[model samples]
Target: MTAERTRALQERFGNALMPTYGVPPVAIARGEGARVWDVDGRPYLDLIGGIAVSALGHGHPALVKAVADQTAALAHTSNLFLHEREVELAERLIALLGDPGARVFLANSGTEANEAALKLARKAAGPARPVLVATENGFHGRSLGALAVTGKESMRAPFGPYGTEVRFVPHGDAGALRAAVDDTVAAVIVEPVQGEAGVVPAPDGYLAAVREICDAAGAAFVLDEIQSGIGRTGHWFAHQAQGVRPDVLTLAKGLGGGLPIGACVGFGRYATAFAKGDHGSTFGGNPVAAAAALAVLDTVENEDLLGSAARTGAALAEGMRATGHPLVAGVRGTGLWLALVLTAERAAEVQARAADHGFLINAVAPDALRLAPPLTLTPEQAASFTGALPAILDEVNP
Candidate 1:
């Protein structure tokens, strides 16, 4: 939080890294629990949780031990060889899906997981079905195949010609989604909560409707739960609330805590769609990452974080709304991944001021502030930010 530490990180980042993400303002030296210290030793409560990662918080002992133990034993072995860690992690993810017959493909990141699911759906649908349906403002990933399913044109138009026939429909619009899925459709991809779009949840019945549509059309139903999975939404998978099981599911973010890992799962008949020679990833399902992910899952269950996320998240949202600050228009989304909708275009200013006050939040949209604090975030930590939010908004209100 100190000006000196912020400048130091910004300078190094501008000079050393690519211009893709631009220069970030703050530099974190280390983190423990729900708080992080800057390079200059000033502390800030990390409410963004590394864009919804860090489910067990920073430097959790279980996750650290798992990574260290697995690394000391073995790290990498391509899919050409057998590894217990990969199989074990895969089994755990499928079990979370409530489908023991499901199959899984591990990847290094969410986008790769999504890419794998896209290819699997395409292969399962055969050559005649070329159309893929995605929601407007829905974000899947940045890889070409994932990008094709993502509805943001600005990000996708620059990368075309995208190598697929993907159609965009309004998110949560049942009629549009139903009309779009046909026999020629290969898959229908949607996010349970549109995290990139300020944590906007689809209407209550939208997911179930999409599942029915995909089923009737014989198209694969894919749910991208990268940001909302692994206990972030107080559920193993966000789509579970709708009581609809997707044909394929993509997950990442908090799955491996701070480590890099992702999973693409297939259920029912779709599980056997991929042939041995059809697809693969050399570094996917490595021991270290798998162990990290397993530890995250174990800690979430052992510590009862899923319950904590729901309870703490509800209290925090209520506290913020109770502030009755002029900028506080409303709050929405689920678990710890809620968004504070602002009445004015002061979200960027609020974000900066909140950081100055030792709180790390994200201005996910011009009028919305996103909070994805660690699932282990205690009531006291939530109160800290919620208590300071009124002043933060006031300081930026002009």
Candidate 2:
């Protein structure tokens, strides 16, 4: 009966929804902690965490209460007036950035936040500098402005003529980056960890090199931490570990604990770049989202989830390596954001097999299964996944 219900729901979804994401195999009904239930009431251990957006997991009391309380009091202010939640959220973000002078522009998603940062870069560049430098295979967002600086060819191919002139360089090649940025460059945008390009991380001192180049070239150093930020990397922000700061930073994904929210922050003088009426969002920083974000932040600190993420992630990686499965090549990434690298391009098969075994993982690439599980994932839950992994891989390979 449940299978029939799931099939009927899938049919309805296919009939009603657009084909942007194709048809999902399972229709999720609800979730809690690191697991979710499908419409058929079947449970699956959720490791992707809604693409790293569900920081506190589904139905977290703090997030739920914050949203409910804020919605009851106030929901939308439209940026026409000031609201305390928005102000508080911005202040909290600046504090987390360790830059008291930084200013934030809240948006609904990473794409919109990137758009704002790109605009700030253009303004900072003025007319003399019009070129933007970005890393090859970097995925920023789908919007035209964000896509202009995004270095992925296939994503940018369909939408040509993305007005701004952009120079793409190798992801971690400092020499290539230095050669690309010159007097004509406005900003250099990159991700600390290239999440979309198969969970790859920047080499040591790479961010510092970018900072030095940007400083010499008088270009804004923009870090897009949409996926790597908000304690996903065991640090409040990924750049904190690098000992370098960016002139502008974009954040989203885990900030709102499943609510839609994003922020584009400008540091020092760049903080005042917008001036009067430069940019705005209708539902950006709605009270409920702000409250949800604040709750997430509070929970992170009170529960010390940063430490938890580090410990669990290390143990999980070690266990996967100990499995010594021939299909398993290695594990990459830090904290809860990881990719199980496989020897062959059987990630899709492995992902399907894992799902059949009551686990939900993302086949981010042909050979990489990305894990962006909730920070609340318990050690036992992680161990269960690791324990089941060998059998899953064997079922796929054998």
Candidate of highest lDDT: 2
Over the stretch 205-274, how does candidate 1's per-residue lDDT look in tens digits?
Answer: 9888998899898999999999999888788778887788999999999998989988999998779999
lDDT of each: 0.90, 0.92
Per-candidate clashes, comma-separated: 0, 0
Residue 46 displacement in candidate 2 (angstroms) = 0.5
| Candidate 2 Cα deviation (angstroms), residue 304 | 0.2
User: Which pairs in model 2 have colliding backbones?
Assistant: none
- Regions of model 2 farther than 4 Å from truth: none
- In model 1, residue pairs whose N, Cα or C atoms come closer than 3 Å (at least 3 residues apart or on different chains), thus clashing, are none
Candidates in order, TM-scores: namely 0.98, 0.98
Residue 5's lDDT within candidate 2 is 75
